[model samples]
Target: MARGDGLVAARHLVHYGYKPSVYYPKQGKNELYERLKTQLTNLNVPFVPDFTEALKSADLLVDAIFGFSFQKPLREPFPSIISQMEETRLPVLSVDAPSSWDIQEGPPKEGPGAKFMPGALISLTAPKPCVKWYRGQHFVGGRFLTRSIADKYNIDVPDYPGVDQFIEVGVDADEKL
Candidate 1:
């Protein structure tokens, strides 16, 4: 998704004792895919193919198909995958930003027919403007920001008293950044 965030998250899942099935876009063979495959192998997980396995097998889904750097107009397979996920009504945790979501503009506009509620959106580093209308749980991750860096980016982050890596923001909370 966003750089190596998805792969990194999958690795974390392994550390947390969850068996994660990673389904990349293409069949696993290339150099990058091989690297990911090796990592997954080391973690004792499966690096599998997508489409059905992703929707039918997993208890929950992680929307890491795209992140903050994703541009407009999703290509083939991704849109279908997202539509299938939505139809399945599975609980999804969007990593950084939801797939098909415009990084700066949020979810795509329904052309006069639908109103869908996307599930939880987790923003790393800082909250993106795309999260404005998200009603579900909003979590802020990437707990490495110093006050000076936060201020430099005009991000008003709260003081993390200890070793907290994640801070959940309420749906109605004012994130002054």
Candidate 2:
């Protein structure tokens, strides 16, 4: 997996004494991935050998494999891994969007790759329209925003109670977002 969200989740899990297993099929060419690897080592996150190891090590999955902006079909072992995850019937907490999903179209039900159900989805900034199809818990993260920023982008800002950051958006959304 790439550094970004994966690294952040790994650090938090380790800090909380949870043995988070990271799945990196190959060494990343980016500087950020290298930095993340070092930080994760310092944090003592277990870099599992492969997808099976990571899946076996986890009770549930925190899917930080790909962010929402990704548009290409997943390559190689990724498709196999996604299949395993689907067959295993594990609860997946997808960050941003489910890995390899079309940014606007959501999961590809019938295609070369990607057709799994995530148990929960944590959408940052703003949720895409496809998030509506998610039957499980849908959480809207990221608090502390300016009204102008939300208005400019037309992102519906949810109200928080006493500094709470995340909101579990249920059915019957206020039509603000």
**Per-residue accuracy of model 2 over 39-123 as CA lDDT, tens digit each:** 9988877788778766765788887777675657677877777677667666788887777677667678775435676788888
Span of ten consecutive residues with least summed lDDT in model 2: 168-177
TM-score of each: 0.83, 0.87
Cα lDDT for residue 153, candidate 2: 81
lDDT of 1 by residue, 139-163 (tens): 8877677888877887867555588
Note the Cα lDDT for every prediction shown. 0.69, 0.73
Model 1 misplacement above 4 A:
1-3, 26-37, 111-116, 172-174
Off by over 4 Å in 2: 112-114, 171-174
